[model samples]
Target: MDNVSQITMFFLSGLNETNNHRFTLFFLTLLCYCVTLLVNISVIVTIIMDKNLHEPMYILLCTICMNGLYGTTGFYPKFLWDLLSPVHVISYSGCLVQALVMYSFACAELSILSVMAYDRYVAICRPLEYHSVMSKQRLIMLVCFSWITPFCINASNIFLTSRLKLCSQYLGRFFCVNWIIVKLACFPAQTTVNGIVADITVVIYTFHGIFIVLSYMYLIKTCANSIENRAKFMQTCVPHLTSLLTFLLTGLFSVLIMRFGSKDFPLTFKNFVSVECFVIPPLMNPLIYGFKLTRIRNRILVVLTFKTK
Candidate 1:
């Protein structure tokens, strides 16, 4: 509580331990970012260019990849620069924007995953009504819901955060987070509205998670008794499940660390935990789908073969 004010800048303390091996870390991080872009873009382009991948499942996957790109672009560019710089500072406005992008990206991801679960449910559980249920108009609306709702929800949080008088300018994590910004507020009472809104947001997304779980549970029970549904689940739903679990695990780790992590933990470990959500899912989702989903995998392979020939 040393220099209370409306902070104009924030010093990021996550990279404090990177001085000894900054260049090496920078190289690895750059490589990771490039690979992430390559895989996500590859999946997105493959789906768009192929006529057969015009189904709701592939379209939803494409949406997920797009979100991956949107989220990672917010973090990686700033982080790579910070890795090489002597002073790691971000303008207060820039910090808020990054936080907005990060949280909205996460929430949007869960929303999209919920959509995917429903898509699979309709496909496997109600094959006769799949087309009418997941029509182009409906698909468009679902995608918009996935993206827009989270943006609006987090935007409200950021709006509330922007009004706070900060007691600190140092963010311990590598990237900006809304909760961290809220924690920096000069007065506890001023954050009452923020706390209420944040809790409501959590409950909303928690319900999304529950909906997904229930959908998949029914999917499993229905698929269990039928050989055709079992094959379909293996072919299509597995990748969705993989992506969901990856996202959930990484996101859960980040939340747990942020809420109850030990300060005695190494900065390196904390930094890794902070970025795991951004790094792993973006890179893994497309790869999981590309390798596991038959249509996408075949499309990618055919394209590669044609280019090589």
Candidate 2:
């Protein structure tokens, strides 16, 4: 307990073995972060600048792009700096904030996707009620719900983490996460509440997964009967599915690796799995929505052509 009180920062050992390849990794990471910014921003800017995209679906797409920016920003800048420096360390407070941002960003994403599923369900299943169901007031509320609920949930976890006496000042991953911090607690009893809250959080998101699955099941069944509905499904729902799959598969791997990863596994491989969620989704979700959606694609083309002239 005295040692924990004296601790001021954590040493991130994830990058210790990469010293031999630091410059190459730095260049690559810098490029990835820049491209992530460019693509996500382009999608967000296109949607915001073009008033024709003021519909519910486009607004949600914009929100997704904005979130990609939020999540990546929380990690990339610190990571890029660590790549350049000899030491990989973060202050206790900074680590907590990063954990909060990363987890909240993830949970908020699933929440937004759930909302998107509802949007599609209304659009396809109850066309007449789509407008009434997704009115401006309602959309605003849903957006708030998506971001806020996760923030509060993760905030509670982080608050619990803040109270613990951490026996270790080292984290395996390049970035901090609540679970890793919880695992460092000096006493097992200290983590009981943390574990309970985490389980509840998992249950909450599991139900979100169930809701999305049920929504899409109905969507697929309905679309099967009508050619027009099938076309709409291809145009809109496919991109959502791609985004959802990318987010879920990457997140699943991260969780599995954290919980069950063998010590014999190469650090590089484990690091890659842990960071893949941050890398892939931010870069791909915008591109998927930008090119896959007709309005966004055409608007981007028009701007590019106008610039060329």
Candidate 3:
């Protein structure tokens, strides 16, 4: 209780091993961050500016790119600053906010992807009724649901975490996370509610993953019988699947590390595992969509060419 009362900031130990390579890491990180911003923004701008690309599919892609920005913004700036700073610490309230941003960003991403799967399913399975099913009003509602539901869930988790009486101010990882904060609680019994909430959150997103897989399964079966649908599936569904796989694999790796990571492992390796989802997904999502989607790629090329002239 006294320890919790005295703690005002958390000391991050993740950067301790990287001091010698701070400048090198900083430049590389800055370049990655900039590229992430440029590519995602390019995709987003291309979608918004082109009236022809204003369908639900393109809008979903734009939502994903926006989410990539949201998730990375929660980490990279603070991480870049930490690379140069003498001490890596964050205020109590700041830590909670970061946890909220990061968890909500990740949760919202899966929610969006699930919504995309549903959109794809309806478009491919019932083409005649696509617009009637996925009307503008409905699209707005789905988008809002994707973002808001996750935010509310994570907010509840963070609220539960905030009530814990923490014993330690030292966070082993580079950033604040609800799980880590809960782990810092002095009494094991006090964290039961937090653990339960976390488990429920995981279950919700796991269902999201299952929904995506089931949607694709039905898609494959339907597309197999039609030449045109097969081509359409190849054109659109493949990119969404690729993005979903990349995001899921990276996210699962991070979650596994957090759950089962060993202290015996090198801090540098652990740090990399901890932050891979934040780094890789932000950089990869846009590149995957940009190169794979013909409309986006052609629009981007035209924009670049026009800008140069």
TM-score of each: 0.97, 0.97, 0.97
What RMSD does each model have against the real structure?
Answer: 2.1, 1.4, 1.5
Candidate 3 CA-lDDT value: 0.90
Prediction 1 TM-score vs. true: 0.97
For each candidate, the alpha-carbon lDDT, in order, equals 0.93, 0.91, 0.90
What TM-score quantifies how close candidate 3 is to the native fold?
Answer: 0.97
The candidates, ranked best first by lDDT, are 1, 2, 3
The digit string of per-residue lDDT tens for model 3 on 1-309 reads 442435689999988999999999999999999999999999999999999999999999999899989999999999999999999999998899999999999999899999999999999999999999999999999999999999999999988887778889999888998888888888889888888888999999999999999999999999999999999999999999998898899889988887788979887787789778888887898899899999999999998898899
User: Compared with the true structure, what per-residue lDDT tens digits does model 2 show for residues 146-213?
Assistant: 99999999999999888888888999888998898988988988789999999999999999988998
1-309 in candidate 1: lDDT tens per residue? Answer: 333356789999988887899999999999999999999999999999988889899999999999999999999999999998999999999999999999999999999999999999999989999999999999999999999999999999999888888989998888899998999988889899999999999999999999999999999999999999999999999999999999999999988887888989897787789778989999999999999987888899998999999
Model 1 RMSD to the real structure? Answer: 2.1
Task: Name the candidate, 2 or 3, with the larger lDDT value.
Answer: 2
How big is the RMSD of model 3? 1.5
Give the top-scoring candidate (lDDT).
1
